[model samples]
Target: MDDTFPKIEVLINNLYDLKQKRDGNFEASVKRVLNMLMVLEKGLWRTTRGNPSSFTDSQVEKCSLQLWNWAVAENTLSTISDIDNAKFRHVACKLLTLSDPSSINERRVRLQIEMCLNAAQAWIVCGRYEMTDDLFELARTCIEKLLDGLAGQHHSLSGSKRMMLDRDLFSIDGLQFQCVGSLGEHDKAVIAFNCVRDKLALHPKEAPFLAMVCYNLALKFHKEGKLEECTYWLRQSYDTGKAEEEYKVDSCQQAKTLRFLAHVCLQWEAPHCWINALNAIELAIKEQPNVPGFLLYMKILTLSEAPDTDLISAVQKILKHNLPSDLVFNAVRMVMQNGRESACKTCLPFVCESLSHTTCGLEVILLKMEVALHFGNEDEAKKEAEDLIAKHHSGKMLKEMQQEHMHLLLWGRASFHIEAKCYADALVWYELSASFYAPGKLDCNLAKLYRNLATCYLELHRLNKAKESLSKAHRIEPDNPTTIFLNLRVALFEGDEQNASHAMDCLVQLANQEKDSVGRLESLPAEDQETPC
Candidate 1:
């Protein structure tokens, strides 16, 4: 005889009738039933001043089902509508009252919210950004209301509330962060991350969640150029998220964090930092050994003044592991760095064989060409360069091979021409060498190139060109006593006594600058002092 009881009973019976309908005709009947139930549910929700338990069990269940169904259908309709769907908004508002956490059927309510959350996500992925935002805001509002309703019923629903809160926190914050990150609003993305960290801090027992938030925060800090803070957060994330026997954390995630930490350490460039990176990478390899870690470790070792024997053994082990091409390229570089040309010889067969399997083979070939050049094996360098040029015609490797090999070939040929006293031919090759390696910029290589060019010009009796090239070489690497002395000799030969005296003054100043042995400067051969022209 209760006034609301009869209305609840009628709605429950109507839902049951809709549930029994054939699938072919169920959609239309279910829509009609949902509309009636939504009105009653909303009125009851507003009138009831306490927890959702103020409603009867049958009423709660019927309301939850309708909310779930309406959320699902509204999501579908939003997808098809070009404009914002006002119908979906009305249904979502009704859902807010039905999803009270204090209700005896809290599990059902939670499931309904979860369905709506998923539907919202689907809408977002399908490019309905506006609708997705609206749906998310509604869902958040509903969850907040549910949390408020459960505040007085903490004893009855504490565990359930905690679980729901954790789920909602991760989902909402993660989605917001992702959306902001995609839009390149890094500042907002960082704020969202800090909010997640704050929530996790309140729930200290959620170590895995805390760790994930910290990891993301560290990445954000890194992007923002907060290196010290990034390091701090990365360590916290790694320590908290480390898998215990009970947790069984994801190995790949752990490895990613470890690699990131290692890279940061490597960037610091302290010897101890490199050592720490090596240790961290070793641990990462234990969890999920991959080519990247191996290669990174190799680079660190090669750059460090570490023992060659151990580094070589480690590189050999990596090669034995059937690593990817990029990793194999690192291994070859390690071999070359250690001055282990014999070790390099041993690796070439495997490296060449692996090249076919990976796009990095060209890189390995170019590295081998550099190694060959370092060892003064022009034939080997030429062959490797030619092979690489034939296989990969356009890329960093091809360009490097063309540039480096041209210089090596022309320089070697020029050196021969100089030795054979074919001064004109040597001048041609030396000019070609300088062109191949132009325009001179650095101290060592540019000085050497200009010195060679000046020698060829002197031999060809082009005193003006010789003096010009020597002056250029001196300007680039001013500290070279040989270049200064050559300039003096050139000034004397050209009968420019004033410039010759200036060059003499420079030579004496250079001699005084040589701290260890002024005798060495004085011992310059007479032939070197005399300009050929």
Candidate 2:
């Protein structure tokens, strides 16, 4: 009845012919045919007064599929190249209009939702945020229609059918949540998260989706530096995803969430941070059983001052897999610090093997220096330190781990002098190590650094300097028995009986069980270090 109908037929026939060819000009001909179809599509809508379904025949389904395939291809390419925006928008609009739930069959309705979501993602990648509105709206409309159809027949649908329905709805909602989050609509993202959370118990397979939503939101806040909110969402993700195992969902996501949570806890002063970090990494290792997870676990244990036995066990587990140089070096550091000479020796060869394969030769060589010092090979250690410093001055070290390795080297050099009773030489390295950190900042290493500095001054009979260093250490860690004991020693050396008596009483109360059981300062000076790096 419409004059444009024949034109559309001719265009489609030409499109079929173009598809049958695979020559140099096939792409051009296809584009020409698509353009002709588009023109006729616009004209048909302008002329038609009949029901919309009158146009959604077999020709329409075939056309929709072809257009969808083209849009998908273009959308993928848009990630790496620019696309024709005007043409993309025209095709998307036609797809949305033709996908109306009131016009297309149920199968086409579902296909249209998929198509719209694909287009919405492409538009997002293309930075056409405004164009996503219609695509998403059409998707929601199709989802709502599908949900309504399911609801009307809920009484007769089987349990599996009901589950499938819930999954489909939840999946759509989850995708929209992710898109809203990517758009930086924080409030809407939270609402979407709550929507998913509220319906979480309706289907067991929905846990992974909920976990992904929480993880994505946490990442957004993390990038924005909103640590408190980021931590809250990560906690939600790990807790909700923990039951993924019981529900038969993939446990890898939960493992990754745990690992990330551990990383965050290590940086922030979260409640029971070290304990939580240890627990999270331990669980992560169990869930995924991979090398990186094991490496993280070993690092956490070393920082947390877990017993040497635990560190040895982690090393043994790691030995079964291909060892990374960093992992081997860390393992050797922990064991050597714990006075496990045999364990350190066992791990050193692996470090050498792994080192040969990586560009991180500076770190591996530094580890060798520490081992030499631990074995009382003073000349070897001194020569290695000089070589390391010369190499550093030459800028031969890789930039990524240079700073961290240098800090460790400085600390090791300082601790070596402390053990040899070379107070003046020790004093210089300690001060140099302290200078590497920001002024007035305090951490485990800084706290111990101040304590050791006070020790050097005390040995040199610089009573005034000893008291000054003790004061700094005390302010940094008030409850440390070692700091209190150092304060007591300073008071004794200063002949200040009153302060000495007070420090003694505090230490007694701290020990409680044995008055003589006052904690010794950390023995391995290079050990028990916790750096953000």
Candidate 3:
């Protein structure tokens, strides 16, 4: 006898004994067992960590397997509190779920499959995709075994029952594909979909199913910024569903497809993209009227050649829908951006009504401050900015702000300080915003931020720093008129006539190309052209 063997035996016996005496004071007994398990788990973990050289991989795995078995044995898992309960079960199933379905007893195979899939789904809902591949694979293996059995005539499953099994197998594949895609395994996701495409084609009802899968895959690609792949898959989704007439596709699915297509067309800037977006959105609304989709349509129309009256009518129609504060704010922001002050004023009361009932998070609060600032409520905007700064420093925000949102807050505060003629304070905020730059991005917004920082530097008479900021902004967007004009200013300040002449020529060329730009350029003072203050 090993010294550790006796201790392990004692803990195991104690755990079992706790379950045996559960008839009296069941909850208390359960709590005791849970506490003991926690202690044992911690002890085992410490022991393994303390003497890592002494324990081989097999020993560590054996210890984990034993602990999981003890934790889940005899309906013990169900009694665990729902908090972190899904996580616990997901981990417990990792050791117990068999990859080879043939190894499980035939009678328990289906039950085991269901259990594994349910465990996998619980984590998926929580967006915890790690360690789920094994669970999904185990369930898929079991399902495929049953599917294979039917193919070989090993069982007398009815045609409908056989189809049910096929659908189950496909469902697993689709989910796994999306899950892997979400995990950033793009090639693996594509292969998974390709593996099932031929099989799905044999069933007409599966066409819509395939289309939905394509749509989901496209969304994943779109999020990853693989626009080419996203567009290809969207086209596939639309074509597949359109080819199947016997079993009509779901109207909601069609609407989702069309809405996504509209977004893609606009992003891609294809020929007549706006018109195509309008057509797609109109068809989508006809198929399924959803508030978010309708709002997207309104936004597109506002950006188009639609007359003010038509845009105002769209805004009026949108107001009739009871929307969340976020959506109402989006509508107001869109209209305000298009210079539709009448429409914006009409939507203001609804924003107030929605805000009164809902809890304001950082996003909604930020949008509200922007709405106030756009409407010339400078005092309110400044107050809100102060409150945001205090809350951020005190760490009292209800939710963690995302990188982009934090940048937005910093930019807004900097802009406010500039308006107040506090150059040093504005410089601090602007520099802080610049530090939040996301890697591998050279978008127009980022260039504008750099340009704004350069402006702050210029105002404070920091010519060297101003030059550096302008260089960064010019690198991001060389053709931007504002950036070129600022570059000209920087070069003139630095007494670099060569660079100043080059920047001036670029600006003149831009003005020549765009007739309206000439007047705007000439109107600015030669020495200090104000920078969109």
Candidate 4:
């Protein structure tokens, strides 16, 4: 018997009594806790020597929990706070060694894993986003060690044991990726993701696990802005997850994956995002009808500028859900840009009610601007725009959306002016819009901006400026019929007959291309007054 066991027991007894006091002397208590862990480390090794009496597994579990509590406590002693984190892995690794051999009892091995996992979870709950990576790393090391040892023992294990092992391994691998991603180590996260992917490959029959692996990878890459890879993995996760009893995966997980895939498609401007999202949500709703899933479906359905199918059924479904006021208001805002008077009117009452509430006031206000423009209520639209400017606070989401709103409102005013035949006013507004939204930037309707600016200049008889705007618009969307037609007009105005004839011939060919796309024009201006056609 190890003679040191007696001294260790005495140390633990004294430390346990001191900890039970929960005295205000946090530094003194942490120092005592460190002493206890140092003594417990020796005791953990004794369990490997077939000495069951040397240390109870419960003692290790309790110590692990105590250390976790100390680490995350808001008022933890600063001097010893980091000590608690450093000591955790030592105790966990010591316990891992105890669970090493098959000679160790199954109950003891399971207890050690559970204790380590609890410790890992504490790191997540207690550590700030920047500090949790080390916590997950400590937890992952223990799990990986366990998996490595268990792989050799798998042949003798029962089916249930195999499943438990697989699940634990899968969970830890996923947690590691999530933690790595949170730390913004994209390369490291991909390594962890690949590890999970390779593990899933080993068990090809586990569709749910496969989906989970893909789902996590998709999410990580999506957050990293690797959109192509994100889309690929999202499609894999969604497709595989939709296969069996609808993947027999968690309903929320299924819904989230499908929603993410739809979002990915939307980000890529894929033609099938809406249809696939609608179908996926329908299936997901049947399994577990969640508001987020439904709300996401509504976003896709209503926000579509040119949906291939009627969205009335989808919108009605949302109304039938009798969702919370916040969600209903949000849905109304999404459909506000649909440019359909009837649809916008259907949501008008809730939108007005939403404007009365505080949550998302800016978003609701901006949507009101768009909705007003949809109805050609220029005065109301102008009021909402001014209101948004008054209430605008600086934030990333708000700033981006605010810029978009300003651009569209400016465009709306220009269109209204053109429709009203106020040529000089149209020219002023269109020129301001073209300057605010430069032609070469992504996420701006630059082609239309330039084309319409050309139109405004032409109306004002600024033939040279009209030709310049038309040339810029042509470079962006070379084959756009509106751009080509305007190019012909600019050439004719400048008496460049050869260029006018070429522009006319190109316009005819593009008209054929436009006809081939029948009912699928990707670049139709939101307001019809954008072009002479």
Best-fitting candidate, scored by lDDT: 2
- lDDT per residue as tens, model 4, 1-533: 45454454455455556656767885576576566666766665754555444455555444444444444442254444543554554454454444324354555556556555555554544544454454445545545555566666674666877787676676677666556655556578668767765665444456676677677767777878888777677766766655445335676777777777767766766556656656666676665566787776776666455452345455555656655545655665566545557776666655556445655567677777767776777778767766665565333134565666667677767877777778677766565555544325632277777777777777677888888877777677776777776666678778999999998777667667667432333354322445311
Q: Each model's TM-score, in the order given?
A: 0.45, 0.51, 0.40, 0.43
Clashes of 4: 1
Could you tell me how far off, in angstroms, the CA of residue 130 lies in candidate 2 after the best superposition?
A: 5.2
Better of 1 and 3 by TM-score: 1
Checking candidate 2 for backbone clashes, the offending pairs are none
**lDDT of each prediction vs. the true structure?**
0.63, 0.68, 0.65, 0.61
Of the pair 1 and 4, which is ahead by TM-score? 1
Candidate number of the best TM-score? 2
TM for candidate 3 is: 0.40
Candidate 2's residue-wise lDDT over 180-284, tens digit each?
777767778778878877777776676776677688878988899876667677877877775544663466877888888788777775447878888888888
Residue 354, model 2: Cα distance from true site in angstroms: 20
Pairs clashing within candidate 4: 244-247
In candidate 3, residue 63 scores what lDDT? 41
**What's the lDDT of the predicted structure labeled candidate 3?**
0.65
What is the C-alpha lDDT profile of model 3 across 1-533, one tens digit per residue? 12443354455466567667756675566566455545544455444443323334444344435544555564355554442444445444442331232332443456556557766766665667775787777777777666675557666677776676676676676667657766767678678777666566656677776787688778888988887788677877877777456865777888889889888767876557778788888787777777768787876787675666666666555556655545555666787788766666566555555464455544445665666666766567656555555554565443434345656656776767776878787776666556544456676767778778788787778888888888888788778787787777788888999999998888789988997775776665433322322
